[model samples]
Target: MTGCGRREPIVTIDGPAGAGKSSAARELARRLGFRLLDTGAMYRGLAWAVQQAGIPPEDGAPLRDLLERTTVELAGDRVLVNGRDVTAEIRTPAIGELTSVLTALDPVRDKLTPLQRALAAAGGVVLEGRDTGSVVCPDADVKFYLDADIETRARRRRGELAARGVDVGLDRVREEVLRRDRQDMARSLAPLVRPPGAVLVDSTSLGPEAVLRRLLEEVERVRCCTPP
Candidate 1:
């Protein structure tokens, strides 16, 4: 899909949490020589700021002023919140819960989606998020929806947390994953769904390398028909 009368290539990879979209998008961007935009990190940064400002997650509403003042920057692998590096800080399970809330609020979506659009306006980018293909970059040239079984996703989330020293049990992780999945799909705004025209890739048993190879094949197929 193309926007703003621009024809530059935009690739959107949307998926459920723990589906490996983030890691795959980073590698895809590098392999394709495109910019990488982790839209989830943007929400995480905003959630971090809101949490820092003592905002209550139970409010169930967007704090306009707090959001307006917040700035999220993605510099390679580092994520900056208001000029402070909060990359490692934003990945916590606590923040993950908060981010789910933040992404659900209409005001928050209104504030952040435009920033995401501007960043990818020039295209030649890989965007990974729950709604990147459906909402943020609907006109993206190529879109992929990566998915895996719930247990697989739970195990992956558990492994990730363990590596980060969080050490959450698989049962606890499974519960959280199911909870977030319900929240994401049931939310009024930007609910997770497979975007139209997106290629579905089930990674239930596929490794990251296999996923990347399949994605590359799709990109090559798209490139073949694109006018030079």
Candidate 2:
């Protein structure tokens, strides 16, 4: 729907892993002339930092402390972890698997919520993450919750990871996806769940083109109605 109360337009695309959130967000951003924010990548950067600092995934205090001294700067597709470019480094399965844990933490969510808000508030933006609509920018003009079957998402994840040269079988990828679902949905602060009034688009049967077309239709309606 239309933005209830905002001077600028913001689109929040939130979904679980491998649900085409990133690709859809990118396409929507280009179509809408909005900046793109891959919030999951931000969490991946935090997970990489925690791992580098020898902090256990469950140690919230240390992870929060480590994050306090670190800065996550998103410069386009480049995710800067403490001023270092580790965008490609954090895409590994090991890092991706651990990132759900980081995103589950209240401390981590507390740290990044402000950053996510500031970026969206600056101007028009299409942000993709678990809680983009629900937590990060609930007041966004359009909220989309993309989804697909676990198997479909797993196959896509396997292809993506393998393309990046991390050879992993589809079976394991399915398991990893299921595990991520549990971890993401069970997370305390900001879980991977739907937001009220969000348009849920299932990509299981629809291709990206169809998804994009439908999304554009929805976004255009919102854009056209937003008060100046």
Candidate 3:
């Protein structure tokens, strides 16, 4: 909902892995007529590049060099790195794991966080990521911390994998989700946290559409409260 003769509001969605941030952010952006900034995909694209170049996670110099040369672009639903489309390539469990580690590093966050801010500088974007609300867009007009029970989250992730034809056991997926949660919350640089004033939405019992509707309601509430 763009305001006439006023800047569009910036919305941030932050949550742990498997919490349905991606799907919610996409639909929310569509309904609001705003751009969807999937920050996780950007990190995954970088991780995929690192994996392909054979760069170890602990190696800082090489990672810095790669960051200097890399160009990550979000074109519609596709993700491109250095002019190569890696949308499908970056969604694997391996990239997810790597992305967790790489994103924790200071260099990685330092490199990407600015780009994320620049993308949303105009203020008509929906940014979704672990740190979008806490770090990337702390002053966003509206912020949401979406979450769900671990069991529900794991099952959702498993279903997503199944849809992609990459079958994985529930137990393994649950463990992976736990591990990512620990890493995301424990990381020193920009660790995941609910931003001040962010509205929390527990999706443990809510479906995607329900969560989207809730977010829309909150956004509308914020918009109505703000002076034109």
Candidate 4:
């Protein structure tokens, strides 16, 4: 919510993939009238660009070079890469896998983290990413670590792909989700972790609206406790 002359709250939603962080964050921002920052989409856009250029994910030097020349614009549900809209292109399962690998690299994180921080510098923003609470916005006014069981998470991801007209088997989606989870947790740079003081919400049996309601309650509680 806008604080007028006062400081607006910075909300960080960090979690594993497909745990409803993005959807909940979007709703949370809408209700609060704040900006929504989807950090994952930024990486996914870059992954699409790299893939389009036929660059190998393992090739750090070239990837970094491409990033330097690339202009990634994330605004209003659109992901623009070098002035071209790639919002739909970057949401595929293939780009997601590439994003997982590219995001783990120090060079990529080094380039993107500052951009994310700049976007949130003025506050009144809900940032959703693997390490947003732990690394990107450690001092955020309210932080939430949303999670669900692995099977539930995989199911959610599969449903999303199906809605996009991508016919993927449940077993394959589950295996891929597991693989990405392992990589995210094992990555040396900005690995996923529940930052201290972050509220944990399990959405295994809950819908997006329920999760948003719970998070809004947390925000109200934090606001009440803060000094005016």
What are the clash counts of all predictions, listed in order?
Answer: 3, 0, 0, 0
TM-score of candidate 4 relative to the true fold:
0.94
lDDT agreement of model 3 with the native: 0.90
Ranking by lDDT: 3, 1, 4, 2
Which of candidates 2 and 3 reaches a greater lDDT?
A: 3
Candidate 1 lDDT tens digits, 1-228? 344344457899999988989878989999999999999999999999999989776444447778778888999899998899999999899999999988887778887899999999897888999999999989888999999999999999999898888988899999999999999999988999999999999999999999999998987677665665
Model 4 over residues 1-228: C-alpha lDDT tens digits? 333223678899999987998889989999999999999999998899899889888747788789899988886889999999998888898998999999878878888899998998887889998988988888888999999999999999998898888999989999999998998889888888898889999999998888989999998777776666
How well is each residue in 1-228 modelled by candidate 3, as lDDT tens digits? 333223678899999878899999999999999999999999999999899989898647898999899989999899999999999888889999999999888888888999999998887789999998889877888999999999999999999889888999999999999999999899888898988989999999998899999999988787787775
Query: What does the lDDT read for residue 189 in candidate 2?
Result: 73
Q: What range of 10 consecutive residues in model 1 has the weakest lDDT sum? A: 1-10
Q: TM-score for all predictions? A: 0.95, 0.94, 0.96, 0.94
Over the full model, what C-alpha lDDT does candidate 1 score relative to the true structure?
Answer: 0.89
* Residue 41 shift from truth in candidate 1, angstroms: 0.2
* The best candidate in terms of lDDT: 3
Off by over 4 Å in 1: 1-8, 58-62
- In candidate 2, the residue pairs with backbone N, CA or C atoms under 3 Å apart (3 or more residues apart, or in different chains) clash, namely none
Tell me the lDDT of model 1 at 196: 96
